[model samples]
Target: MIENRKYIVILAFLLIGMVYAAKLFMLQVVDDTYKRRADNNAVKRVMEYPYRGVIYDRNGAKLVYNEPVYDIMVTPREVHLDDTLAFCRLMHLTKEEVITKLAEAKDYSYRKPSAFLKQVSGADFARIQDQLIEFPGFEVVPRTVRGYPHKSFANALGYIGEISPSQLEKMGKDQYSAGDYIGISGLEYQYERFLRGKRGVKYIMVDRHGINKGAFKDGKYDTTAVKGENLVCTIDLNLQQYGERLMNGKIGSIVAIEPATGEILSLVSGPSYDPNILRGREFGKNFSVLQKDSLVPLFNRGIQAMYPPGSTFKLIEALIALQEGVIHPETHIACNRAIINCHGPHSFPDLRSAITNSCNPYFVNTFKRIINQEVNPNTFIDSRIGLTKWREYQLRFGLGRQLGLDIPNEKGGFIPSPEYYDRYYGEGHWKHSTIYSLGIGQGEILVTPLQMANLAATIANRGYYVTPHLIKSIGESGQPLLEYQQKNFVGVEARHFETVVEGMADVVDHGTGQYRAKIPGLQVCGKTGTVQNPHGEDHSGFIAFAPKDNPKIAVAVYVENAGQGARAAASIASLVIEKYMLGEIKRKNIEDYALKGKFVY
Candidate 1:
């Protein structure tokens, strides 16, 4: 019996040895994962980031360029710091920060590298690189940070920051890792595909102490990093700078576009911060401060702030009335205060005179005839049908919808359709009277300043407008984008625009816009609006184009709480045009009034 038990024990021991041997073979020979992990200890993989594209103005002025920066990466398992205080001092970090970062890195991955410190300036990197060897497990990765030479175009130019976890996942692990910087807004985000170049990789061989021995396998697997494509933007640097200067200390936006090409000349969002404030270690802090600002300096008001188009929209109303055959250019309407309020002295005004005087009652009466054309016996049903047609025409004018501006965060301003009223006031319950303010470009009719600028461009073109774009060309191609080259006709006849053009010309020459919109030696055409605001004072608004025959520049300016349209908005628009066309502003009084916020109600 004892001999039999001994044999069983020996058999059991043999089975255990065989199981152990099989497991060892599977790990060492059959599976490559452990082999790769072992190789990772000695072979370091470094990502070679590409230089982001340079942004230039139309006339070849550098707006955004790159400056050298460094990112400090650490592998928790490899980190061996004997003098923690010395290392912290050299890296400009506290001992607690060092420990916390190491612990966090370990939580992420023991062997994988993670960013310990980000966006160290070139000067600071140069100072710290020599002493980096004193601390193990840490490596420096060279990178570039955007530098704004002019310190202008913050909201339009956009900014970059470390990618969030969600963005990283969407970009995919093959394309982006955890700590990659991505464009967050504006032109940066719009042109990210062209701006962010391809990333390369280098397999570096290192010794036991993490010292670089040489390139792994004689650089056979290493790839050369390709520089990003450069972009020539449509912005005129001089014009943009001058506009920004005029818009400073104000709470509004200015958008100017070349009527001939649809290329944006200048886009200024007031109370903007310098682009430099968003680049470096202080980014998070500065961003928080800007986000909390009461005026919202970070908001791009040009393409985002939706405001009532005010009387400037009267021009469109006249054109629609003309096209619908409800009202002619010579159609006269009495200034009936019972229908709507008007500040002008003109009692019975024609279409041109109504627009020139910004007679609200005329437009309201015109809208009434257009909406209540007796198409249907029921008032609500007729209003619904009329509003649908009206909305269609307004969309052709690029109102109440996104104009597809290249930048991000462009808001499609609301144009109340019959459906919208149905949703708000229930279906068939509302009529033209409920939405009458839309006639004077008030009530639910809203338009972004960008749309207003595009409206001026459309008027300047006599019937059509190209899609406004910031990038003139991409990757050294001097030609404008094909999409921006095609003119979008607003379904209005060219001859109809002539009557509105004359009215607009009179607006700058001798009407409501005369005080500030008139530019001497240049036949300026414009319309002004005192947009109503229940919160505070009325918003000043103006849209204009210069040299009535062949327009060069089209501009729209909106100033919040600035009272009459002839005040801040008209002055700013006129100044922008003078600087762009005449190469300098000779109207110091207009410039000073806009800059000093001197708007008298």
Candidate 2:
């Protein structure tokens, strides 16, 4: 019995040894999947960031650039908060501050790592770098934050911000992470891909204490991130700055463009917020403050705010009427107290005189003749071809639809139609007289300030103008606005526009805005508009371009509640033109009159 027991024990020992050997084979040779995963779990990857591209104006002046900032990252699961007091001292905060910050991070997401503090200055980062070792889970990481050296073009340059949940859904999984910066508005948002760099990943080995050891396997599969492409805009920095200064403390917008190329010279929306406010993680709080303001500095009035084009649209109506053979340029209409209730009575005075005077009755009478087949041979319903042709003309001039510009906040202003009339007052129920005020650029017709600027630009270019674009160039891309270089014909022959141009010339020569916008040596042409605002007084607007022969620049300005279009808006426009063309204000007395003296309502 003793001999049998000894043999059984020996057999049990052999069985145990065999099982151990089999397990070893599986771990070392047959299966390495779990061991590989275990090693990977300890590997904490670190990203080496790339520099963002720069922005320059048309004259090669830098507009936007990057500045390095430090972010305090924390892994809550691994937080060794033992020396909380020391950590707070290093980071320029009190013990309670650290605790509150951590609590906020925890509330955001305990599962995902969150930033405890961000936008730490270089000095602040240096103060805490040595002492950061005291905290197990905290580390300083380098990130790029927007630095607007000029702090001028807030609504134009746009701002970079942390991606939101809704934006993430739009970006999809592989494209973006929560902390990644993306353009929120302006040119940045419009060309996000070109401005946003390609993302890269890094492999890192970590220790048991959750500390980074080194690069994993010498970075065999690592990729280097590519920096974003730079953009050189067509904006003339001098004009843009001057325009901003003149429009300060007003509730209005202005847009200026080069007539030949459709390159935007300047675009300003008043009540603007400083782009510097969106620099770092405090963006959430800063944005909240801007959003709550009554003036709404966040709003881009240039392209986003649609207002009645007012008398400015009369040119479009006249062009449409003449192009469709509705009325002769010599067609006559009598104006009286009963007709349009203008400041005074007048005769047809030819198309030139009517345009110069902005005769409401002439337009109202001419508008009815437009839909009359006896005159145009194209009633609103009968031929349909002529009406469609007129609509196409408006679209070509970028009046009825979007202009496909680089700015992200652009809106398509309204343009009425026969079908639209059917919806509003029913089929054929609304006659030409019902919407007759449209001829005077009133009623349902609406346009953005950008569009009105575009109108001035198109007319200045003679027959056609390129679509307005913001950016001028990128790295390999020679120019950012090349796509908008084609001439958009507005159905008016080059020669056919002569009469209108002459009429506009007469306007600055003798019309309401003449006192402010006239230039002695230059043939400046302009139109004034008084767009009715929701508030008490209507908005004053003036659009013009100078030296009519070789038109260098076209500008439009608006002054909110400034009474007549000639009052403040024309004065501002006149000053900008003088500054650009002359490079110096020839008349200091006139400028002082504008600057020191107030406008009489």
Candidate 3:
């Protein structure tokens, strides 16, 4: 019995040893979780940030590029500083700032790395990089910062900054981290994903002193960042620079578009700051100064400012009237100053002459006929019906609503509807005569400079226009946006545009706009407008498209507090068109006059 008991006890002990041995073998050879955990103590994972895409003008001029910058990163658990005060002084940081940063880093992760000091210039980084080894947890990480070679187009090119908490939440933590840079506005904001590229990760083995030995596992678990795709914009750098020069000391805007393609050539909002001011460490300070300046340089006036279209809108009315058959090319309207005072005296004139002379009474009378025609016989119903139809035609022209411009925060200028009038003046209280000012492009009809430029483009195209856009092509594939390629047709028939075009041509040939807008060989079609402003002097406005047949450029210029379009806006438009077409301005005298001209309220 004793022998049997001894054998039983020995077998039980053997079974226990086998179980313990098998468990040890499984943990050491079969499962990788513990092995990875062990590797984490000796390995560090670092992110590789790719270079942001380059931005170029239509002519392939580099507008924005990236410059190498270094950021000091830290891992809290690995930190072993020889002297905290010396380290703070080396990085140009206060001891309190260093402590605060360290605490924040600990809160993020003890083992993971985080940015400690960002955007250190090359000179500063060079001075301190040799000493970084003294601080075990800290290392210099290479990154890129946006750089502008020309420093112009601040409002159009935008700037980049560290990602905000809100942006991180929206972008997803997996895609972005706290230290990532993001585009804040303009084309940068519009194409961020394509410009930012893809980030990558690399794991490297580190010794007990937190010094990188080499890539972990011979770079088996490493990735290389993909460089961002390049962008080609539609802007003409030369024309844009010239327009900016002409608009110096001005408070308005200029927008030029390629009529056939709807591609914006130059969009200048005056009183702009150099893009360089919004880059580097001084951005916040410079931005605050610009924000407080009286000129409001940050405001994008081309697509955001609302102004009455003034007499420039008369071209549309003439076309709408012609399309409705309420008027003909030969039909004459006697200019009666008693009804609506004419800017100057003129006799009975046909459609073309009326437009050339800018006869206010003729347009008022023409508007009256369209509204009071015996369609409904009931005055209120007929007026409403007519106004509704007019609004429809106006909307088709890409007015009264956002044109879906690629830029952000475009305002839809107001075009009063029947309901809008009805709310203000009761159901049957209003008539065509009540709103006669609208016929001459006043009384609640408003448009941005961009829209006005588009109107000129639509006229240049004779009936259709594509939505104006800034991007010409994206990526190496040079793919143009499909939406901008599609045409948007106005309600007016193509045939009706001929009379209006002839009238515009006549205006430049011998009418109010003649003195300032005529080019020697270019047949420029243009109209002048002196918009009434209660707060100050009239705002000068002009719209033109040059070389009447197969037009190349359509432009709109607005000059605030300028007395007449002929004085400022017309001359600027003419110079811009001439410069673009002829490549050199033969009219140096005119250019000098425009550059030095002054206007008083």
Candidate 4:
């Protein structure tokens, strides 16, 4: 009986042992899923970034571009530098400099590739090419840095640079890394999602010499890098360049548009910088220089700046008055500056003349008539409730708010309603006398140079606009945006705009805009404004379109601290027109005088 029990126990023990052995064999020999996961840590697959999109100006002029640069990448953990002296000599740095750079690189991160030398010039790269064979892990990778064929659209084209860790934290870990370049301003910021192409991943294997082997697994797992889609802008390079030249050494902005289509022809913000300075090996140094320039070159004064629309708002008021039936085109108002204590003493024959002279009291009277609903005009918003109706009309013209333009950091110009005054004075406390400055675009009403330019474009189009885009198309052939499809606006009729146009023409003929605006062959209709501000002298403001009949171009120019519109603004805008239409400068003396001209505050 004892022998039988022992035999049974031995058999049981052998069966249990075989079961564990079988399980061990299956896990060790058959299942490799966990082992493969562990192996992944050893082979690091780095992503190779793609080239960014190219930017082109109107007529196929290249604005922003990409130039080849060499980035000296070093994996601190993997790098084996033999002779520090030799390596430093090749890289055009002292031995101690290499050690310092390597220390900094190590401080940043050792597990990943840390760029010790960024944006090495082609000349420097060539000098170090032969010496690179001595370094075990240091390698030269071809990369793209932003380039500019022209000086810049600066505040317009913007710039791109290495992404910071903060940006990575904000963006999360989808595609971008610590060293990726990204669009930082202007159109680039607005359209980054579309402009930045999809990034691809590739599995590369390296040999003993650190030379790249063919793509891992015959490129079956390799993703091809797609070049960014190019953009074609409505900006006419010639016109834009001309406008910049006109405003060179001046402080302000100019925006020009195709009247009928609202396609931007030239958009310039003064104190511009050359985009090339922010690229290449000396980018960091050059950028610092621009940053310290007394004249702000980084500000896009066109879209981002807001100033009192000045006399230009007179045209809008006239049209609004006409549409509301508060004033007829022939409504005569006597302007008596000495007697009635108004801006003018000469009696205007009609509303057309009133607008031409930009008579303050005439429009002030018209505005009061509209606000009180003195005439039986169609009611969209109730004016009897307060000056609410008139305020609504002004707001609809894209004043008092950011037009939601495609550019970055656009300003929302303020519009003060009756309620605004009510906050300070009771609703009935305010009168036409208090807000008369609003009639001539001088009061609290504000608009950006971009918005003012659009005002001209909207009038020329008779209603609809294409959202005032710098880029006309995207990708190949430049596709147009769908939301901006040509569509008419509500509010004012085409007939309402004609009298304002006539008044504007007459202003060029005999009013404050007479000098420097007359073109020998072209009919330029415009309005001039001299703003009253406590801080500084009046700013020069002018909005105009040429060839009165078939308006080809509409423009707005503003020169900050310049007292009169005709002083510099009109001449600069006219010069830009001449450059675009004539294809050559016909008025050199005029341009020279204008360029060298200065206005004291």
How do the residues 1-601 of candidate 2 rate in per-residue lDDT, one tens digit apiece?
9999999999999999999999999997899987776764566666666666778899889888888888888877668788767677677789888888888877877756778887787777877787776677776778888788777878888888878999999998687877778888887788787878887778887755556677788889788889988888888888888777777777888898888888888888887878899777688889999999999988888888888887777777777777767766787777644866664345646787777888878777777666555534435454233345555777878987888888775899988777777788877466665776776777887788889889988788777888888877777557655577678888777765667778788888987667887877878888888877776788888888887787888888877777777777778887878888888788665576555425564
> For model 4, what is the C-alpha lDDT against the true structure?
0.77
- As a whole number from 0 to 100, the lDDT of residue 496 in candidate 2 is 58
lDDT measured at residue 191 in model 2 versus the true structure, 0 to 100:
77
TM match of model 1 to true structure: 0.91
Report the C-alpha lDDT of model 4 over 1-601, residue by residue, as the tens digit: 9999999999999999999999888777788766654444334365667888888887888888778888888888878876777777778798778889989888988867778898887887888887796797787777888888778577778778777888888877686877787887777776777677877877766665666655677667878778888888888987888788888888899999887666789889998888777776687899888888888787889987889887778788888888878788878976755523444446765888876677777776777676666333433233434367777777677778776667778887888877788777675566665776677777787789988888887776665455777778889865767654555373888888888777778877877677777777877888887766668877888888886788888899999888887777888877877777778878786688678857541
Over 1-601, each residue of candidate 3 has an lDDT whose tens digit, in order, gives 9999999999999999999999989998898777866665577788899999999999999999999989888889879877988998898999899999999999999988888887889999999988888888888789999998886777878788889999999999987888899889998888898999999999998765567789999999999999988999999999999999999988899999999999999999987888888877787899999999998999989888899988888898898898899999899998888897787557898999998989888898788776666779888888888898888989999999999888677889999988898899998888897788989888889999999999999999999999999999999877677998999999889999998899999999999898889999999999998888989889999999988999999999998888798779999999999989999899887788788868531
- My TM-score estimates for the predictions, one after another, are 0.91, 0.88, 0.93, 0.88
Candidate 2: Cα lDDT at 64? 89
Positional deviation of 496 in candidate 3, in angstroms? 1.3
Clashes of each: 0, 1, 0, 1
Q: Report the poorest 10 consecutive residues by lDDT, candidate 3.
A: 592-601
Top of the candidates by lDDT:
1
RMSD of 3: 3.7
Off by over 4 Å in 4: 1-46, 338-345, 374-386, 426-428, 488-490, 599-601
Best-to-worst ranking by TM-score: 3, 1, 4, 2
lDDT of 1 by residue, 1-601 (tens): 9999999999999999999999999999898787875664477788899999999999999999999999999988878899888898898888888888888989999988888888888888889988887788899999889999999989999999988999998988887777888899888988888899999999998766567879989999999888888999999989989888988788999999999899999999987889999998899999999999999999999999999989998989888888899999889999999988898689999999998899999999999888888999999999888988988999999998999888988999989878788889999899989888889999988899999999999999989999999999899655756888898999989999999999999999999989888888999999998899999999999999988999999999999999998988999999999998899888888888777887883
Could you tell which candidate, 1 or 4, scores higher by TM-score? Answer: 1
Which pairs of residues collide in model 3? Answer: none
Give the C-alpha lDDT of model 3. Answer: 0.89
